[model samples]
Target: MTPDLIILADTIHTMDDPPLAGPEDSQHVQAVAISGGVIAAVGTRQDAGQWQEADTQVVDLGSATLTPGLVDGHIHPVFGLDLTIGADLSSASSLDEVLALLQAEGRHDDGWLRGWGLNPNAFGTVPLHRSVLDRVTGDQPAFIRLFDGHSALANSRALELAGIHGRLEFDQASEVVCDADGVPTGLLLEAAAMELVQRHIPQESFAQRKARLGELLRDFARSGLTGGHIMDHSEESADLFHALEAEGELPLRLRAAPWCMPGSDEESWKELARSIGTGGRRWSIEAIKLFVDGTVDNGTAWLYEPDVRGESTAPFWPRPEEYSAAVRYFASRGIPTATHAIGDAGVDHVLTALESLRHEVPADVLRRTVHRIEHIETVPDDLVARFQGSGVVASMQPTHCTHYSLADHTDNWSTRLGPERADRAWRCRDLRDAGVTLAIGSDWPIAPFEPLPIMADARLRRRSGKPDQHPIAPSQALTARQALEGYTSHAAKAAGLWDISGSITVGKRADFTAFELDPLTTSPDEFAASSVLGTFVDGQIQFMLERHA
Candidate 1:
């Protein structure tokens, strides 16, 4: 049978179990042939020639290293369209910089001042309040999403517009933080609280967002991502993915998980279950996303002990038992779950919940089910051990540790937890050594979405391209091989898609990422700077580094 497409590179990682063939340093397979969007042949260049016909489209990426396409274990492409609108404050380090950028952005003086990715460190000693931002915007009615995405800081005008006065109640662990005197501080914690002000802001048209998402996915492909596990799915997400796929081939294959929040009951769970597996060619809803707790920075995370601020002592679900039931309910029907559990107690609860299903389900069902804990930010030795021999995949963002916290125990994340817990940082190496499946991701809009830097940061234990910065728990660093596997092999294991994708085995889907240098052999710093030669999804070229008109 003639192959429809042939991809020939100098090196291929394969990332398979015994790796099919090739030494550890280089050369797994020099060429791969695809027929009907699946790998038909994987062998040397000479072998590829035998399978190709005259009409076979061949791409020769000379000197480039090909591997199973990189997939982000967690991302929020749909939700990010709204979060990333207005000013991009991701690079603004200080309050002065944030204000300067916001002032320039909202110079129009009439519209709402919006921003996303505002680092909590920018507040420094000052508390996060409207007064600080009110200084700049006056009455511009600003609503800025913090770097954590769990919280937002709104200006006085914006709060007034939302009719937020003093405090409000929410079924979830959400709070409209107020001062001792019963005045809204403009610090909204968790989703319910933030939506108060967010609803007042102007929204973009569906068509506008659809166009932007298409552009974003192509950018993700150019940055060497052939797939993503989207953690959050909106009501319009399926429509958006369908629209983009109808236009042409989607650059990245996306798997979305819609949230099952606290206020939801069994009926709500049933609704989500019915919506599962509804998608187009390149996208599908295969899993459910739930939150066990909010972030550590906002004092909403479900920590074993309160931070220095006397916060993070509660779970997002007011009734912790219901969270477990939600997991079990979905797991029984054979759907996987990816829950956001950052704090130690949150991690403990999720682990305990997964363990409860052992007797109910058969050993085979238990073995096959893939329930992951997203953002296992900090945990003691015992909890880390629970993941070993247990099917609970640890979905982590290495950049969260590398970019957010400081080694000195002074940053918000570290300062709150104090020295002992702070000493335990990300623990990527700890989990890997324990035989846990660790899938790496950017948790984009919260962190940068580039997979190269995320991979580099996993090994570096500090921000890539900023060697001058000290590593946050240097001992927790993963090896070059472990870091790459987190994005490929382990990521596939996390989503239970290891059989069909993840690696370049024959009969697997023809998804691949080509980089200028071999990811495994290249130095961490140099690898982070790799120019992606191209990204291919299902035997179709998403984009090429160099395009000829």
Candidate 2:
């Protein structure tokens, strides 16, 4: 009974626990034996005797903490890694700084030039209009996506390209902001802005995109992420993944969910579904993605009340009826729906739609589908009970609290939501108590994709920078063990791969993350700053941090 590989560590955390009234129990194992890319044994050195063989490759990770590889349940990986090449205005503290950065980057002769990460609330004033961007961009089609990715600021050149001078003929949920003189403001909110920007940004070739994606996947391995869920996949992205798999360039496990638009034809969706069959040993395509609303930063998150500034109740999906139809259609066809809902109104609409679908459809079909509400921020207290045993998963990001903490106007979120609703923000513990399965992720480009920051925030209930700025109810904060499980087993279960890749059981895949510090005992600050020592997928070392001895 010789194993192919054996990894010995100082500590190991296997996330196995039912919902507890308190913290989960952590188990320590001295070694793990792997055979045929699967865990053969998890025990002390003596227990490993049964599986030890002469040819077994033993990797002694002297003092590292070993656990199941982290799974990022939601991320825009393709765009995240490309930010370094574009106009990175994420750290621009003021309008002048943003303009200066753009000017320094120089102008492109091509009609389209893009930048991202500009928050109007961070400046404490209304963003400048197209005229301001035009002054600096000088007729180049410039589109700056807000940090939340729900809105964009477009220059006059971009607007002209989109044929929207000032007033835009948009559908129900999209808006074109205009100044008093009927001129297009550079700021385009929600779907309208996205539509305008989409018209100008030229699409990349499949080869180029795949190369960039492969680079990013390797980067993930270096960060100790052995597997992740692609939140938004297009046909081009799927093709890139398959090509990598065929070429043996895919180093990490991939679970992709193709984007499903609100009004997509049923036949078209079914065809797309048929195209994505069951995944192999390293990749999967078992989910569908939908968006119910935009982000709260750009005033597009379909809020129940007006934003604190009294702007407006944010827009929902363009065609609510059509969106619901799409959800029903996906569910009827056996594809689980993972809908993005950031605002209270968006959450309410999705819940109502799901209930309606359940009433109309057969109970067995409804029960089998893995309907998820992504980013359920600002949830109402009364609705907490509805999630229990309802078969809906909550995929939430913990780093948003840190990002939004820097916002200027917390008054609206604080007042409209009040202290009660604010306490429920990313309510992991409450949802767990209510019998809801929880999964964790970093929205990637929205925040750093590192799992340490997420784990720290989840456990400490606040960013490591400030002590007094805890966003949610501290009681709702998850224990370190629960948070880790949310990123691993719970995430795998959400993606319907629990039996194969979540834990270090005998039959599961040998995917593990080696951390420099013991996540369970490390201080929140240290954990947030700790580095990944290495990552292994299917018993193969994909990334090993070079030790500077």
lDDT of each: 0.89, 0.75
List, residue by residue over 239-273, the lDDT tens digit for candidate 1.
Answer: 88888888887888899999999978999999999
What residue runs in model 2 are displaced by over 4 Å at the alpha carbon?
18-28, 79-85, 109-112, 202-207, 278-281, 309-315, 406-424, 465-473
> Per-residue lDDT tens digits of candidate 2, residues 1-549?
579999988887766444222322234476888888888878876666666778989888878889888888888876554443468887787778888888887765454667777656445554557777887888678887777766677888888788787677655456788888988786877654567667566766778778888887888788778888877765556566678888784678877787776446888788768856655557767788888887666566777876665643654656687778888877887778899987777888888888787777787887667789999877777667777766788899887765564322253244445455465667778887787888998887877778888888888777765577744557778877778888888988887677787876768889999999988888877888888999989899988888776
Q: How close is candidate 2 to the true structure, as a TM-score?
A: 0.90
TM accuracy, model 1: 0.97
> Which candidate leads the pack in lDDT?
1
| Regions of candidate 1 where Cα sits further than 4 Å from its true position | 21-28, 107-110, 547-549
Clashes of each: 0, 1
Please tell me which predicted candidate would have the highest TM-score against the true structure: 1
- Per-residue error (Å), model 1, residue 207: 1.6
